[model samples]
Target: MDVDLPYELQLVTDLRGHEERAWQIAWNPVEPLLASCSADKSVRLYNYQPSNESLKFSHIHSIPTGHTKTVRSLAWSPSGKTLATGSFDSNVGIWEREGGHDGDEEAADWECMTLLEGHETECKSVAYSSSGTLLASCSRDKTVWVWEVHPDSDFECMGVLMEHTQDVKCVAWHPSEEILASASYDDTIKLYIDDPSEDWFCFSTLTGHKSTVWALAWSPKGSYLASSSDDLTIKIWKRVAEHKWECALELKGHERSIYSISWGKGKTGEESLGWLASTGGDGKINVWDIREPPESSTGRVLSHKLIATLSSAHDVSDVNSISWCPREGFEDLLATAGDDGSVRVWKVVPSH
Candidate 1:
């Protein structure tokens, strides 16, 4: 940890269960659960209790995703009833509780209800829309697929977008809209929206990063986007028009490839929009407080201040992913996945 920072990242607990590299960690949108996918071909779910003073996490269950390869990514539905797992087996698995419960019980068994197989190569990422009515996935096949979520865990592919020239690394949906953003090995980010009358199509392509764009996060209000890249920098893009988004700010601090980033509500409330947390091969976690510039500022100005830095967060191993807790009263909490096969929970505590 950097002593000069105004905030400190206090390690709450270490979750040891994955037998191989933990690739990604995601907090349940509506439950006290955090799900992590691993190269061991399994996904582990942990239950957490958060309080003002401290936080506690316990391993609850492990689901053998049966993907025959590494589970690269996993995401929870907005209702926290369904889990989607993407794998190198070129398939996406949709999971639900054994009895269709709402995750009220930690011991409830889970089963894979559906397998959506269309990608010809490895599936890299999966995400659910804000409304929970749609799912988006990307693959090494250089395609992005939108799936319509139906009753009884049924999924229908709505579109197969072939925009990225290389493997798509990640996919993220706007916090409050149907728009989707995808980062890729092609070193670009593509924004897609549905015509409703026709199908989903790319409306904008953001190209500023010199290397592969690894991850993307949207502001709380969905007005801006933050992207991390293998170029070792994070860029903030602002929507200047109905369909145009331009790079408004560039942040450089990481010493290696930036793998993942997340934006969530911050301590400063709505005025600051949120804080951005990023981590990657540098084994460091950096948190920034991003604020919109004053109304008089020109060029859609924005400002950011680094509030905290956690060096060697994974003890010499690369940190693969970082995610912010989205639940009320737990906004200060964060979870990170490391190549050392451990999941660590942390809280951003004020130094003062």
Candidate 2:
């Protein structure tokens, strides 16, 4: 069921080194580095540079994270100086360059600065806030923990949220706010905010997905959020009121469970809502252009167009994770991690 897509995903390269399933992919927001974690209990880093007309990626370092179990997720700090790894061992490891340098030559020497431990079970995902002052991690123990980042690689637990009835799958911070969103196996997405007078608490619980919610990504403007689910669908949630959000649209196309989705500012110009890319157990990568309705229209439904579809994106292997390059000039680039233990890079180009 493949057709000529409007945009072509040109193969850039395939990076193979992980010995087990690749679980996640994260691109540094301020640097040209790409990181991926795997079931092999290791995190691999790569350096990419524009080589002539295309980009080239080199395996610069491999970190054998001392976690006793699989490294499930990783995220780069906003400053691109530190990396956080969440593991099945129920601990989060923070790593930084030995000398605190951003040079590619010093990428290999990294030290685990601190280990955050509180979760009673496997940690599913970890993310740093936009200001790099707060970190969030979710676990299979059905709770989400927030950490306050301090100077000299120190961290303090700010809040432990136990609102979910089942395992928490993912946690994502708002693009420009301290508000945090967590998806869970309970088939609900909860949004939490801090009350300066009090502490962190859930302000809203979004319920629509019939099955487990696997991932969540917010729009560039933070006005809308896209979530993928085990029910083989994606739902776009729009913030209508100050503390309320409603499902604006539902996307259905994936033939299997949708495990990952990424929202990025692609070639959609400044006014349009960014592009949404999704991949999952079907081994297909689908990119959609979500358009915000005009101001005059009082309708709640938003329109979307399928711009590209790359079937068998991982060569018959389940595409576990998909991440868009967060750099300025490389907004059209995308990276995906597969169950085959390989990472592939693709460039979106206009079709003739």
Candidate 3:
């Protein structure tokens, strides 16, 4: 057995709230809550207190969506009051917490405010933009849809993007811009920017991966975008021209289809450059240090090191989703869901 690794995992807890596969997990940006959805046709929210001795997750609430199928993805609104969910039912549900003010949000009742319908088949993913003004959803119908969130919880169809020849796998918005990116089973990634004349239009089509592109994540500063593919590789792209993008780096280390990738700030580096944590079908969590050389001023990445590799993170159960805790007290913590029907929190020990 290999020993003396660079990182060690402390099993925070084996969160077993879902009877079926835990498909996706998300962290609320404004609050200390974590939301997870599963194949059991339900959405579960938990309030996590890192210092709790025995019980780490205080079960905040659980809502049985009553969808005909599985809940596959989740995205919380910027204010943390609204949650958008995508599911196999071919519909998007917008949930809002009711009667909850600043003081007692935990006791607020969550109600399904509205449902957005248009997808021809299973809705694979949904994401809210940084401003919370737009929500994007991708479906197996091979199309991407953008919605305009109104002040009264009503949404209007902003645009439908149909550049992908195959099923759309995931959609992600730029960190601080209105631009959006979508990955597809056709092995292509498309970037869309808001156009003044036409609502939203595709400006770039990124094609390099040999197989289906499963997921895409924008860097914290929006300078780079990382895409994971079924071909067991991750490609990082950056905008070079006005709307064109060039692949800045290609990371190939995973053995199977890469499912999830998250960009975050590295703990001990220049505040701008960050690290990445990815988990996938190979059931391994790989953290990378993406940075430039010392005293280098060209603003170009020199090398990326595989700082930590934790194999069988979820007991080799096809890890599906991972979200690094962005809170100040839990910078090294990550929440992951897998086919084992459980959510596990692991702390990264960089000192190891």
Candidate 4:
């Protein structure tokens, strides 16, 4: 029998004014707000909240000076105090949260802090490490740059990760590890680990996807990794003995290219093997239950079962990105941004 799963989707907000596709969306780690960047050359912030048994979002601010061309990717710092965005103009922008001092009734304000210029082509992705110590960005220029974050110093370029032969689409940091993973149109995922000398080097390469690998994420526990591709499949991988990673399982359900992937935290105080959620060009979101490898298995081996499937979640356009909100109490909430110029939120309920 087919497992029947359902999702309660509510149109949280109609983020308009983007003449082109919306590429990326990110949620603040400390506040109920989201930042979205689009091909319209603008970035917008929304005050998001749950209301009337649904998600409600309203636009509060917009940044037009951050990028001269299309803004493709956005990320928030672990402290939730800073925002970073990447654009087709070959630049990255850092935004700082201002206001909110003692007895200040005004809402927290945001301003562009600095602009990073290095990439020669469009920058595809930007991410802040969990410790907020490093900012990483990947670009069509076929290189990834790591920046050292200092409150007193402007964003300084620390090192460059140069390996991919094609446009790098995404970069993700391992939750608690000193490892960074990046996916590229070159059909490869490169893992960079810091050496004893405090310099980062490419430790390993994961190659299995037949097409472009667009998105990648590390599980919350930092035990497993997930990558989605234009090949229309999601692959789960695990670190094996001696700093090597092997493909464990392959999930094949999406009818189109998978654009984004995210891992969900387990129940309260529970050690989660974790769940993988992905969005695709087919306008669907699928959640996979990542299982632990069998005891007798050698190397990295993971098994996964399709836990839930959401069809037409973004019926109006292609769902470009999916993220699980990072609030301490709202682990079941999922947010999606799409080409329809809207961001939607869904509540995930497990099968009882």
List TM-score per model, in order. Answer: 0.97, 0.98, 0.94, 0.90
Highest TM-score among the candidates is held by which one? 2
Query: Model 3, stretches more than 4 Å misplaced?
Result: 1-5, 52-55, 100-106, 293-302
How does each model score on lDDT? 0.93, 0.93, 0.86, 0.81
For 1-352, candidate 2 gives per-residue lDDT tens digits of: 3456679788999999999999999998888889999999999988888799988899988999999999999999999989999999999999988753647444358789999999999999999999999999999999999999999999999999999999999999999989899999999999999999988999999999999999999998899999999999999999998899999999988999999999999996976698899999999999998998888899868989899888999998999999989888888899999999999999888877
TM-score result, candidate 4: 0.90
Question: Candidate 4 deviates by what RMSD?
Answer: 2.8
TM-score head-to-head 2 vs 4, winner:
2
Model 4 misplaced regions, further than 4 Å: 1-3, 6-17, 50-55, 100-108, 266-272, 293-301, 350-352
**Arrange candidates by lDDT, highest first: which order?**
2, 1, 3, 4
The sequence of per-residue lDDT tens digits that candidate 3 reaches over residues 1-352 is 2344566656777788899999999988878888899999999888866464433777778889867899999999988889999999999999988876674657777888899999999999999998999999999999999999998899989999988999999999998989999999999999998788877889899999999999898887887899999999999897777677888888988998999998877575564357788989999888887765457566544367776778898895999998877666566677899999898877767543
lDDT of 1 by residue, 209-275 (tens): 9999999999989999999999999999999998899998999889999999999897877779799
**lDDT score of residue 231 within candidate 4:** 97
Give me the runs in candidate 1 sitting further than 4 Å from their true place: 50-52, 100-106
- Candidate 3 lowest-lDDT run of ten: 1-10
